[model samples]
Target: MGAQGCREDGRPETVLEGWFVLLLDLEAFAPRERVDAFHHAMTDSSVPNEIVHEECDAGMSARIEGWRVGALDLFDMRCSGLEVRRTARHVRQHRDRPVVSVSLQTQGIHRAEQAGTRSTLGPEDICVFHELAPRTYGWSGHGASQAVTVDMEHLGLPVDTVVRASGRLRASPVHDLLLGHLRSLFRDPGRLEADPGAGALANATTDLVRALLTSAAHDERDGRVREAMGSSLVPRIMAYARRHLTDPDLGPERIAAEHAVSKRQLYVVLGRAGIRLEQWLIGERLEAACRLLVSPHHAALPVSAVAARCGFSSPSHFTRRFRAAYGTTPSEWRRHRIRSIC
Candidate 1:
């Protein structure tokens, strides 16, 4: 029988008829060796991953065991701290089909980014990402997760609905059920492999996932956290805020006029997202100023210039807000970050 994750020619083929366990280990190798090996494995499996280690010197390890269930791939994996990206290059390279990966974060905080949308999944949080789309993924120091990859069209899912709810499944009854189902299927592949009902099991697992996604979509239609932040309209709202962040006149009235909405309606939507427009604008300006202060691109810009560029009318006010928000002066933050990076 062939291995589970390894493809003879960079694509998964159904060789092991029943459910089987395929393990990829990177323990014996050095840090650099392990990183490169993992990258190759991911590409060979058609995952299209690009990993970046925050600490290049840190040793890393990973053990990924995957089960082939019909057209779906169920996997349990654990890895050291690193940032993984699925870029357009890889997507274009693996032009066969887009893989849908739904992961349950088991150990640490898993931060995932799709396009420009970002979400963080804590312990037991089930988040999904599209493998063909451009994405960035990272975890705190070390993390472990269990995931299933299936073709989006294979499941006949509503593409637009699932796209909006990506990376935002909180714990609920349906989610718990789905998690238990996956845990049973992947955690004990040998038992499942022996069973004659492997095909039935795979079908049931897919059905449970569809039901869970339906529940999430229903909840989000009422304006869940994901909709408030990652919905179709949120990007435009964010873009306008960013473009005008340096304008002292940027406020609720300005946002309302630009977006062609009444100031009252704007507040209602922003308030639903648990944000006040005035406070959010101020926060954005402060964050922008901080980024400039610490960034090499703006390294030469003086603190006063940064404050002015970030819509601050007074340097003292900016300093006070920055200190209050970050518990340090802008200059102190820049100096500390520079020293650490160096």
Candidate 2:
């Protein structure tokens, strides 16, 4: 089938390569019930389902809830699945692709092992792993639990970078961000299409994955330095730009002033990252305008209104820039997007 073929289940057979998302809900089921539901979902979805009842035993229990979001390259053909078991079992063979699984427990304790290292994950705590490698996971039914699987390729992260940042297992705030975004995506796919900042949302997911992997593979001292001086700055700048996207005066001078950094220093920071500050700001504003242009909430608003909301003062200028960035004029893009959604 072609990459765009749609399945009967409403999921496209082959999602676009850049990024795709999945959201699952398990609030209706308890811990054991949730695992059972997962087992059924896997088997029903054509995933491997070699259930070994002997491996089932009481471990730690907890409640699980949240979202998982990341970029995906559909052409990669790397498969991943989520499963829960009470006891850790040794497996001889695993998938060939790297896999990172993150989980949150409301009631129990969970332990995962890889490369001779073991880590226990507690309630609200997360665990990550490479599925292609050998590993063992054990948990007790102390309460309900939830987990998600991310194929390394879909994560839009470099394997060596991730290994260096986190290695086989580690935890960070990025994991929580990923989970939360995933949950939100699942809860309302429409919001993704309607969100004025959808592009940023997508970019954030990919960026977070990259950051997590980089942190894992690097040394602790270096990682701390990067996090303190380098890592946090980008997001702050991004947030500042997004908030004032519609302000005509929201240029580098104002941005630098707000952050208490010299314009030269701000430029240096962005330049070192190989991105032009002005171009980045323009791209962000255009993306926000695109969202409003297509959003049902603001669909009744005039095209010029949308452009103005995104800081575009001249209609012609906005049209030119929007077309240059997205390859479609604002009106055409909105029409096409609306048709797709309907």
Candidate 3:
């Protein structure tokens, strides 16, 4: 095994029954030799790319350990502050061998940008990147992460779908499940690779990647539909509220749950249209109470009955609001309307 399967620092590559391991530790090399050796090791392991460092000194050190199981390649990398860019030129070169990488930040901050979306991830937060597109990923201070890279063909997803899913992984139900699985895999890759079911495990992992991408794409489309319907959403909410005006439990929380939105989001949509929910609700209930008070069909009903019909739990509260709104009490308003009609 040349530099491809063997280690660059002269250590023998650890090979299990069904795995190919690559280990590179820059600590063994002299400070001056570490930087150049790191670049070579990175380029040789996966893709052709550029690695840049702002400052290099005795403090700079990098280590990479990877295990290849079938088409899945798992890598754990820890390094000082540095940046890596897979530019358009690099994308063109690697166009024939497309791959998707899902990374989980383990320490420090990891900043990644791809397909016009950028993310700053903390520990346990996951992000996706693909070799088919240009991306910039790096960290400041000390950073460490474990990533699993698989061929796009194995995932059986369209490149555009993968790109869209990269920024929206949490939308998929399998996100947490996949994250936990990857964490377990990285925890004991040695034991896992030696298992007789390693090939089946690889297939299951591929299926999960495909599922995550497909579900996330569906969710993004659904989100777009919701966004497009924003103009009608407020009207819908208002109509629902009106229909349920007699319910004593009706409020922002209930309305939001009925419409599949957050209470804050409901307020935001209504606020954009200059509608205050609480005030609007009160105004609507008061209007209903007035109609009931004046209608001949409801002439036998008392003021308190009208208030209850309009969803006011407290008759005194309705009296106060009615007096404030109409400049008279409910009884006085009803009497005035009756005399005017006669």
How high is the CA lDDT of each candidate model?
0.68, 0.54, 0.77
Q: Which residue window of length 10 is worst by lDDT in model 2? A: 72-81
- Per-candidate TM equals 0.54, 0.44, 0.59
Candidate structures ordered by lDDT, highest first: 3, 1, 2
Which segments of candidate 3 are over 4 A away from where they belong? 1-20, 54-58, 220-342
lDDT of 2 by residue, 1-342 (tens): 113333465332323322332222333335455455444543433234343322235421222122223332111011122233322332333345645654454345656555566677675455554443445555543334444456666565554454334433254434444445444344443445455765555555455555555555655467553653355456556655666778988999998997678999998887876769889878878878877887789979988888788898788889999888889889998999999999
lDDT of 1: 0.68
Which residue pairs collide, candidate 3?
none
Q: What overall lDDT, based on C-alpha atoms, would model 3 receive against the true structure?
A: 0.77
Q: Which candidate is the best by TM-score?
A: 3
Per-residue alpha-carbon lDDT of model 3 for 86-159, expressed as tens digits?
Answer: 99998888856678998889988888888888898886577888788888999988789899888887766677
lDDT of 1 by residue, 121-159 (tens): 876567777655677888868788888876777655666
* Predicted structure with the largest lDDT when compared to the true one: 3
